[model samples]
Target: MPDAPAPAPVPLDRSAFAADAVTVAQALIGTTLLVDGVGGVVVETEAYDCEDPASHAFNGPTPRNAPMFGPIGHAYVYRSYGLHWCLNLVCDASQLGSAVLIRAIAPTEGIAIMRDRRGLEALRLLCAGPGRLAQALAVTGAMTGLPLDAPPFRLLPRTEAEPAIAVGPRIGLTRGVATPWRFGLAGSPFLSKPFR
Candidate 1:
């Protein structure tokens, strides 16, 4: 017998990101994210709101974080530790400064491209962290403020039933350490770290 065909990717409506960051984060699990058709399934994410001290938007908009204060359904790409790019999906209404940080993904498409960009053969390490995920997908500061539904980016809706989600405090955060805003696909080996 032949193997079953994978379901066609469903385009996620931009309106789907109009909710708060936490809501969007939890909903992002299992969805597919592609950058010029090179990406994979979202396995982990963290929510950030303007009120959260650990969030870049906590102190209000700046030249760099202005996109977080912009409209929803846009990218908020930024550099972390001045070393690597991290990708965030702006959510909520304009000026709300809420976004979901894409932490990890299970590579399902464009594996070769991800491997070349990451310079690693380990599939698990390709997109298992925000910085690595951004690199694997070729996300950069230039992508910031761009509409997620537009070219070079394609966020597909989850075609299957929602997977079980695990909740935990966000990683590398001193403030809001106990907020439990991090969400991930329960039992997914692709997560950056195991959720406790």
Candidate 2:
């Protein structure tokens, strides 16, 4: 694909983003995701459906997961290992507690600051992992429950290059490993390490 104009807002209405979990994951890739005071990063994410009991919000809304219960395109940041922060994009309007986990990102700009913030030496490793991407982009509990279109974080227009998608098991989830909810750029080295 040659250089082209940026895509218009992907109509992130309540219904658009509130689709099945896997669909949300595939749709996020190539979509520009921005972080305020930091910068933007293109999304490369994986979905975890609510049907899967292993999902964090599968049990329903709580203080930590309340953001997922909101309308589509909201940020849901959670703490992991009592240290790192992982970001989830809200979806499934009616269910009110479903989200797609942002497994990774391809840093589009601000590479210098992002690398420093993440303490990473290599560019590929900057946003290679879920927690690393969030930390590098300044995602935290404070950014949770925020709208994607507003400030702090934004999902910019999708680029012209459409990545071929491949689906597989969601990482870290043993119960639904066979569900094929994970989506990534086919043949792209940046795709998450295939679940073993």
lDDT of 1 by residue, 65-155 (tens): 9999888999999999899999999999944989999999999999999999999999999999999999999999999999998888899
Runs of candidate 1 with Cα error greater than 4 angstroms are 1-7
Reference-based lDDT, residue 20, model 1: 86
lDDT of 1: 0.93
lDDT of each: 0.93, 0.73
lDDT tens per residue, model 2, 89-175 = 888775666788887777767888898897877877888778888878888888888887677666654565566777777777667
Collision pairs in model 1: none
The residue ranges of model 2 lying beyond 4 angstroms of the native Cα positions read: 1-15, 37-43, 194-196
TM-score of 1: 0.94
